[model samples]
Target: MNMLRPACVLALMTLTACTQTWVDTKYQQSDRFATWVDSTPSPYRLLAGDDISVVLPFNVELNYKGRVAPDGTVAMPFAGNLPAAGQTLAQFGETVNRALAANHMTANAMAMVAVTQTAAHVFVGGEVGKPGELALTPGMSVMQAIITAQGLLDTARTGEIVLIRRSPDGRPMLRTVDVKALTQQGDPAQDIVLQSNDTIFVPKSSIAEVDLWVDQYINKALPFNKNVNYDINGARSF
Candidate 1:
């Protein structure tokens, strides 16, 4: 614990006094994560390796089914290859329709894009064994993500785990969860069910100097894998 003290001091000292004020105003502490999070779900964006089926409403013969290529495209029946990754189903459908109409493949080019499969994931970092992205299985929770990340380090401050998630409006919101309750006290309520694209950041030590660590690790250090491209929020399931 004392070993992490220097890092805490160095991290905190680098910031100006106003930074602390900003943190206070910026990260509101609340158990009601749903309130801060957007109410609606965002459309699923296509990604490399995601399986999808394209249906031509008018030209049924040209319907195609395939996976998004590693280069972020799909090979179609008539339009050849079109970019699929990063675009939502509706957006991708529009792209396909435009391409079909331009080439005069069909008079009515309205198409439907259906997601057959997706590689949903969540990121876990800091004070964990194997900090990286993990596949987001149904009902994945905070405890599960930590365990999948190879579990926590001896220096982990489980009481101050920071969960950053994007709201429906696309704004990033944060929550501090006390997972120590679940790990140490066996309190099931401490386990928070995660969303796809959610990130779980366990702190190294004291919450007294969390601002710097949050800025350093949560903001800059961790890699935000574009899978689901989500910052996670929680809905309880205990």
Candidate 2:
């Protein structure tokens, strides 16, 4: 009888620990999504292949709107072929300003550069609501990307969304993001800033389902935690 008492106490303690852990995990995941509502704006740098519109203020003749050439140069009437590849919009604007000044075309001229369109795009593939290439616009966020992909499919694993990107040296990099947390909890941090040529993959809901299953298992392992045990494990035996 004493041994049964200890077992019962141990079970109760285990149950309490499991309940706390489950609550912590739930809260953590929920908090992550909740914080996304007030997330800071994404600061993604422009890259090659982005289309830009450069206006010289009442100088339509000098204004250039076109795609960044393969070599990263845009041909302006007076500026000739200028380097724009691998340069941010600000840098490109500065380069254009310097070029215009050097060529004596415009002295102390103010150049208004706007990204009318963004050619830098990423691909979203697999078990998503829409699987295809998604064009990334300036100020685009991860949530936007997923939304552009038509949201996740019914079988989409919110936590298994994988972001594949290229490193500075062109090496492939992979990052796993939680889409469920982002959408359900409003966590903006999980919505990482995307880059040109980035790829997002929404694998089937295996991972999330597994996590839920694990949570269920932990609940089942707990003793006297009726609420969690019933909710997670299933109908009670007696």
- Backbone collision count in every prediction? 3, 6
lDDT per residue for candidate 1 within 63-179, as digits (tens), equals: 888899989998887887899888988999999988888888875788999877666677777778987667665467898889989998877777767666667765556666788
Residue pair clashes in candidate 2:
32-187, 33-185, 33-186, 33-187, 34-185, 36-188
Error of 1 at 56 (Å): 25
Residue 192 lDDT in candidate 1: 73
Model 1 steric clash pairs: 38-168, 165-231, 198-232
Stretches off by above 4 angstroms in model 2 are 1-48, 58-61, 167-172, 206-238
TM-score for each model: 0.45, 0.61
TM-score of 2: 0.61
Model 1 TM-score, all chains together: 0.45
Off by over 4 Å in 1: 1-26, 29-35, 38-48, 51-118, 207-238
- Candidate 2, 25-104: lDDT as tens digits: 34334522222122244444455567788988855678888877767688876777888776766777888888888998
Top-scoring candidate (TM-score): 2
